[model samples]
Target: MVHVNPVQVIVDPITVLWLNAFACNLTKSLSTAGSAPAPYIDLRLEAIMPRLVLETTHDYPLQRDRPSTLQLQTTRLLVCNYRSPDPTAPGSLAGLTKCLERLQAGEMAFGSDFPARDGDLQMVPDRLVQHTLGKDHVQPAPADVVASVPDFRRDLPGRLLWEEPRDVVFIHMDPFWGDFFGTSAVRHRPVPFIDAIPVSMWVYQNRNKVASVSDGRVSDLTMVLHVPSLISLQLNHFQYLFLLRQLERLSEMSALLTLDAERLLGAAGAGSQCVSAALPQLDISLLMPCLLSSKDSSGGDLSVFPDSSSVTSFQEAGLLPTRVDSLSEPLAELGAGLSQVKRGLNSFLSSLDSALKSPDDQSDTMSVMSDMSSDSDSYVLLNLELDKSESVDPLFVVEGALKRVPSVEIASEVTEDTHSEVSLSSAMRKRDVISALTLRLGRVELVHQGAGLSSSLKLNMRHFAAEQCAAIGWDEFQAKFQLRTKGWQGLDVSSPPCSVRLRMDSTFVPVANQRQHRINIREQVSSELEVRASELELALLMSTVTNLTDFIEDEILPVPLPMELYLEHIKLRLTEDRPPNNITSPGVVPLDLRLPAVHVTRDGAGVFTVQQPTPGGAGAGTGPSGSRSLVDVASSFNNPASGSEGELGRLRRRCQLLEDQLEQRRGSEQRLSQLTALEARCREAEDEVLGLREEKEVLMKTLSYLKQEFLRLDTAHSRRTDAK
Candidate 1:
């Protein structure tokens, strides 16, 4: 009677982690006889053991045996506790029924219509809606309400939810709050809803369910990034979705960076320059690994980086190649065009706003609406892709087997600049194998097949990083790096790997949402200001279209959206937010975009909502799109803007405080560049000083010898001459 110990399991609150146990029987030839009968082992939940502390040693094998070796097994079944499943269950019989009634009734909302990746990934999930209908208190149903079915897992994992003998997986919730699983807490590892989960299931509204290729579900669940307590949440969700929207942003960023790198190449003089000027706060997943793509009909090996080698710079990584250089003219033109259009639109918005503010502007509202009829209606949606049909990447053809890398828990720790420093100039050595494996990812072709036509990636890491160490501030920022070295290599975006040219391009598509999106902009304000005040309906629409396009295309890994469809699933709680007292960066500053912009210390999690007061009027006020006249104007023009802003009186004075802050940031960037150049000059001067010092020592020794000889000669010559 073999007894397998109860296995502990845990699920992360942010991501789903499914455990798959791998098993194989060992067989060998018997000495002086027929081959030993092959043994069979089955991978099952029975062999999973959790939190079993092993000795502090290496090379440890699990040695756990499977229960169903060499034989067929029966399917596992679950015994759910809540025939009226507990509130603990996300979508059990009772729990889901209650949520459904509330959603259909419209008392609570599912909010699925809201943009999935539109700068609100951190929206708190809604509360569970519960209603009690006493025999005496039942009410009649509304005719307009519609109900929705909630999603649930088929079976639990690891014998978790049974009283006597039940299926393994079970969850223990804190009643109205978080969940606790096995010996592990539920925050770091959340149980995945399996069973009914189809191979092509994707996230929709708030829940995970089966999806088809045609359905435009978001790609890769959600984007993951590490904020250094130096950046804000606005970039992660605002400005743009970080790392996740790779395909859309890469090529565009590449074009911009290429132009900047070219212009700065000569002026910065190689010794002094900056790579991130124009596109400030632009995050293109830095060096993410996408499939190396091509234009050929058949798939072929297309390795951008060799397994053993690394990349050094954007140039060596392939960005500054002749082909990328050819793109100079187009990129400059596009940038200029976009900048002009944005300015023109802003100017038009401001002019109209100021006109609306006039006392007589309201009197001729009808005339204003008539004037807005000529605007253009085209809306641009980004549709990034690999630029070609499905083709094999050369990097994957390493033959026989891929290199095996060991796992290690990676977390960065910031110390108060301790350890008194060691002379590490000789502590490190470069890898030759990495240098030999380098490749320049310089191909740019068009893709016409597959769900098709998006961008792809290629790279060589080691050489790239080594060559660009100065740009990364290697001398001062070298953390304690150690490795077990079982072929474990990484291109950690938090710390980008050595060398690689990065290209990011966003595709533009047209979209027309039947429902009108609303924003209010007066002639007196800037569009940037308008965005800050009202919802950025255009930005949201554009982002959603781009995300949907990427989801339909193979640019991102196909998967279910991470959240539960239930709106309550969104009101998710994170760690408590505190003031920026614990922040350590010297550059920390909070600049209010509004008037009298003041610098405040901001923290990593400082992405709270700011509700500003809007202009209100007598009678029924305008809707989200502002006055109807402006909407009509834009719609009539097919959506184009008027131009120009009047001279700013005292009310429109310059924000000197804000300007100071920007200047400070620019100065810091300049200082960083200057320090790099100064270090090079110092190195050169050190070589010269050392050589001169060596010569001085030699000359002094020779002079001492010559003086002694001179004394001897003078004494001898005086004696000889006197004697003669």
Candidate 2:
């Protein structure tokens, strides 16, 4: 019971064939059962079966006549692979249209093997039907059928006449299927589907001829324009313009327009103009290339076009807008000023080139002078008058005026050693005058203006030794003299002369070392005078001295002199008799005129004057005044106690000097100790050398004795050998 026999089943050829046919029939029945009638099933099955075989071989139908009544009742999906049999043959699409009519098909679709060669075959049936219907004088589609089609769908409704060729609603012309047939027969002609079909959408795979669509029927059609194919078509300017216009019309008709291109309808040659002009009317969202490539196309360079009027037209058409000029006023002014300066600099350079070529060319120089003169006038016009009540500084006003004046270059050929008398330019002379006045006035505001002048003067003075100028100092180039002789002669009256004098006390001349002592005394006096002068200037500004002349006479001038001079003058006055002019009246009794007399007076000419004691009356006053004028002078040449703060200050100074001398003496003692040590070491070395010389002499004597003994031995040995 458990043993199972292996069944041997064999299949016959006829049975296998029958099973295969039944399976195929069942599949066909399942696929077409919904739309097909039961009685016409066999005819529909036969029709569809032959199509599958014909597609692969691309063979024509054996029976070229109309279908039977049963086949007509069945729904048909006729796929025509429109490969033009003969391109030169007229009415080439007639056979395809007649075949669709014989089949009584409501819908037709086209496919291509080689899309580029076969071109757009979807429009072939439409164009053929239009030619037939025009001859037959047939009416177009009814309003009801046209209105039933949605505006967004790509397909339009078929025409009312049964004899008219049905619109080829769906197309797939992929080159992967088969080889190319040829260019589309209806490519250049108007699309006939727009007239025949009111609710039809046409698809193109290879090339697009959107411009070939009739302008009248453009509103009825929904075109899915393939932009890549459109570009490949290489349409001219007018074609692009026409296509854009048709798209605009379709949009107005509420018909759907889709662009299937990858990026944009790229412009070639004159097509760019059309693209630019048509961009505003397009649905920019669907046009990726237009969106990306020309996002700023509205602001593109209008100057690239030859005709300005065309650019204006484009602007008016809303394709482009005029760019607004938005420069700020201040920036514009700055730009203009920079441009003017550049022009002026260029002109000046050119003039310089010509002037350098010919030294005698004075034209450029004259023009420069004219420009400078004009600038000077402008500077004068721009001068701001100061308020008198503001109490402004005079020096500051003078500096501001100098700053406003135009600067000029000065040329000179002066050498260092050889005094080649080079003439100064007018500008240089003017600058020198200004510098001299500034120095004489001693104003800080004028320091910058005089910097160049001071540098040039110092450069000239450096060639000579200081000793050469000892007699005159730097007075040969006196600031006052230069100002007076130059253009600043009138300024001399306004500015007081800078006269500085150092007066030494007469009590301190040493006849033996008079020259050297005088030099030392003069230096000390000058230093003291400089310090006192600075103090006086600060005091004049800060102290309660109403009259500067009186202040100078009482404070500055008398403070620099030694206290001994004051005491000497007082003593002389006390010893001598009063002058008769000093007697006030008989009753007044000369009012003790012996008291320390200062005798300060303003002369009749308003010049300050101070009276000095008679030279004979004061013995110390009889000596030179250049050596003992100031407090330092008193310390150097007179008693150390004189003009010092007190005896304590003198004592402190003396102690400091004694300490310095003590240090120097200690250093000298250390040097002497070191020298004594070195002498002792040298004596030891000399003794050692003498002992070495005695030793050497003994060695020499011993060697001489050895040589004599050797000579005797040699004589004895020779005598022995002779005996042998």
Candidate 3:
């Protein structure tokens, strides 16, 4: 007989610490191969329960010995309580029932049609109704004649019962005698009814299956969430129904995310080369249509289920109150969030398509490579094959295997510095392979198809936080980068290894530039690198710098830098690959070798520098040929007829002078416009001051006239004070 110790769990308000220890122990205990029944692990809660905590961590083996089933049942009870605004008003159970009864009866008050007298032809429009008493008016009904009538639904106009605010606002009226007679439309606001309703929800993860696919196992999960029929006591029903609708939408989103687990897992490789024609291509144009369906011209389509008329009829007939579910407004919002994620995915897909269409997108220009995808299998072709098309959505079928060809080998002679050739195969061999031996993603053909096709993405930006002053958000502010194929050798195939370009697009809308900004960024990145540390770190560092620049533009800076600074169309190439163009003389080092906008030099002292390339000319003091100092250029200005002054040189000098003058004129025009605006404001201020002086003079004259009148009246009254 084996006795297992109880797992002690100390619960706190927020974090749970000891569960990990127990999980470790349980995992260790479960690993032992034993025929005996699994030991029953008892759970002991030692501390006060804050809320509810249910955390499951599973690390399944590559192949299971037998099929395992997990059943989880979670029940939650939510009780909402509210007090009557007027404590003195009666709120007994009988009175509350009477209020509901009156509410039901009131529905028919406007819904029913009055019969015509003497068969007279009468045309009555629903929009207009008579309020006056008629000769044929019957005695008031028993329900209306009751002296102690509940003021629940009587004060509200009969037509606007459904349109009222979810939470009732009770206005307190005084018992003053004059207050009642002052207004003809005296309203008797109801004391809020009993609002203590309990809502219970039972969630069951009943059906889940794990089946083998061509490359990996596919998991089918089904959850049934049941909320017991709730009886809304005429108050807070909308709030309750809206909450349940939100829960339903959340469950749907969770199911979607779970079903597409592969996409989430391999999000880093979302931009892998689209060599497979079998994989379903996403039509990004449909994103707008999807979102637009959730809304209409009337703010949003908040249509009630079962039809509002039917529900009203049911209520008027004194049946059980019908539960009318509101529209999926929250679901629309969730779709909006998903749209942001889809935009990022679209960027990745679009870049892959573009790269496939245009192979020469990358150039051998002398610029520092910004986010060059040298790490991992960024430049390797991932063969994706879709299996079980009937069960899964096409977009979620992202399973694939990495092709093990003679991996990319960097050319040693590409740079002047003698660096060893690093093969992609050697690097992959050194890295930890996760289930690579067991799970094999199948291959797809048609890699060379669809060449030279135009793949342009439409840009549609949504300002989600437009109402906010200090902050801005964009749903489509995404950056797409491609991986360049470095020189490779020792390949059995004729063509180079398909350069893979993966996108790590942001999944959330970033908000910045608040009045008081406080961010505690804790980046806990857990990743396995399949490439050189230097290359991977450089890529990550560049990404971090890009994010930092975006933050600066969004928060600290009032206006972003010029469009050229954005680097939207700029390409980054290695300096060694692209040497200076005009190297006329040997051993002549060019001052500017077409370096990146910002270059980080690696020496004993690491330093950062911005490279501002001077205009290409001998007189610019940097380029090759006709090397003249600044003093020599200055002397040439005085001596126009110098021997070196050819027609071409003269033309170049005039063009340079004109360019300088043009720049100065532009600056002066900008400053002059600003000055004009300031001067116009100053003139307006002077005009306002002069108008104030005129008004002051008029007031002074009026004050003098009033003083004179008062003096005369005082004198007249003082002489004959007894006349009153």
Measured against the true structure, the TM-scores of the candidates, in listed sequence, are: 0.17, 0.15, 0.15
Candidate whose lDDT is highest: 2
TM-score order, best first, reads: 1, 2, 3
lDDT string for model 3 (149-183, tens) is 46544553443322211111111111101000111
- What's the CA RMSD for each of the models? 38.4, 55.9, 37.6
Relative to the unseen true structure, what is the C-alpha lDDT of residue 106 in candidate 3, on a scale of 0 to 100?
25
Mark the regions of model 1 whose C-alpha exceeds 4 Å error after superposition: 1-82, 85-92, 98-592, 595-724
Summarize candidate 1's per-residue lDDT along 73-184 as a digit string, tens digits.
1122122212223654332434434433422332112233212112212111221122122121123433443343332233322332322211111222111111111211
TM-score of the candidate numbered 2?
Answer: 0.15
lDDT agreement with native, every candidate: 0.25, 0.26, 0.25
Model 1 Cα shift for residue 578 (angstroms): 18
Off by over 4 Å in 3: 1-660, 663-701, 704-724
